[model samples]
Each structure stands twice: as structure tokens, then as C-alpha cells.
Target: MPIFIDIGAAYPNDNRVTLVVWGEHYDDFAEMINAVDHGNAWLSVTSYLEVYEGSLQMNSDNGCDYTWWTGVG
Candidate 1:
């Protein structure tokens, strides 16, 4: 069982990083980042897959958690 999510612009830790995915989907997001190398170009896409493990909650599985901070300070 794995969680999947679409990578998008986020202000987590003030890094302004994209979405964070777990399991086998991490690589996909990484690739997008590598392709688009520009000023805030990575902060464009939005997440699509919202469901997590058949639930509406985010579970912190150590470092395997697919949760990314999209909150504003």
C-alpha cells in the first residue's frame, strides 16, 4: 500500500518546494523539478490525487510520509 499525490508549489519550511509524494512516485516529481529550471517555475502545478490510503487523512509514516506543508505563514 502506497500513497500518491500530484506535485505542486508549496511553502513548506519556506523552501517553496513542490508536492511531496511517497513510495514509488517520488521519482516522478523529482523529474519535473529537474526539467523546469527557472525562477519559481516549479511552483506552477497543483495536486490532483487527493485520496490517501483510501482515507481523507494524512498518516506520518516516519520519513515515508507523502505529506508536504502547503500552509502559509
Candidate 2:
């Protein structure tokens, strides 16, 4: 089965963010996120939406949400 990860932003606030990594193996998803170094960014988990598998989706009320899904063909 193909693995999948769904990450979504909960609130508009920078602190009220949510990051979820789901896939056939949780470790893979976690590793991907950790590799990105998301902690360096100013935006919190709730600032955008990210999905790994096919495409990446990002939404923000402040007009600064950015998401990039690499290694997808």
C-alpha cells in the first residue's frame, strides 16, 4: 500500500497550529518533517496544510501560507 501523510492548520494563530504525519510507517512521515527543518520557520503548524503522497495544500488567513511537496511525479 502507498503511504500518505496529511498535515493541516487548525487556527489562524501562529501557536494554534497542527501538524500530522500519517503513512504506512509513522517513522517515515516523522523523518520527512524533521528533515524539512520546519522548526526554523516562523509559521506554526496551523499556518498551513501539507500532504505527502501526491500534492501539497496550504491555506492561511494572513495570506502567507506556503506548502511544497517534493519527490512527486
Candidate 3:
């Protein structure tokens, strides 16, 4: 199964983005980067994380719920 995330959820209902991820990237995330728009918001495997952008993570905790940056120079 893919992951699901809500972006800009606090904004107007129509402004919200529901992201789904099966592998590397999320649906709109690619659009923001000028890539093809598909699937939901994606997550880098914990192994790919260089920095965790969120306060909580860990597979036991809702399966890696949080944000992260990978391969930062």
C-alpha cells in the first residue's frame, strides 16, 4: 500500500493536497519540481534520511510519520 499525507490542509478545503506515495515521490511533489504528477506524497526510506525535519519518527510510531531530507550536501 502507498502512503497518504495532507498538504496545506489548514488552508481552504479546495486548496488542500492529498499526496500518495508508492515508492520515491508523492503525486504533487513531482509537480512542484516540474516532474510528472502521480501517486501520493512520498517518503524516503528511513535509511535515506540525512536529516529528520519532524519531531517524531520510527517505524513503530505510525510507520515513519514525519518529514525528512535525504542526501543533503
Please, what are the lDDT tens digits per residue for candidate 2 over residues 15-69? 3334444344454345555544443323233345554343454333223323445
The Cα error of candidate 1 at residue 43, in Å, is 3.2
Q: What is the C-alpha lDDT of each candidate?
A: 0.36, 0.39, 0.35
Encode model 3's per-residue lDDT on 1-73: one tens digit a residue: 4553444442234444434344444442333323222324333333222212432222222233434343333
Pick the winner on TM-score between candidates 2 and 3. 3
Q: Best lDDT goes to which candidate?
A: 2
Candidate 2 whole-model C-alpha lDDT, 0 to 1: 0.39
TM-score versus the correct structure, for each prediction: 0.27, 0.23, 0.25
- Shift of residue 29 alpha carbon in model 2, Å: 4.0
List where candidate 2 sits over 4 angstroms from the true fold.
1-14, 23-31, 36-38, 42-73
Pairs that collide, model 2: 17-46
**Per-residue lDDT over 1-73 for candidate 1, one digit per residue giving the tens place of the 0 to 100 score:** 3432223333322323334445555464564434443333323443342343443322223233222222223
Superposed by TM-score, candidate 1 places the C-alpha of residue 28 at a distance from the truth, in angstroms, of: 2.5
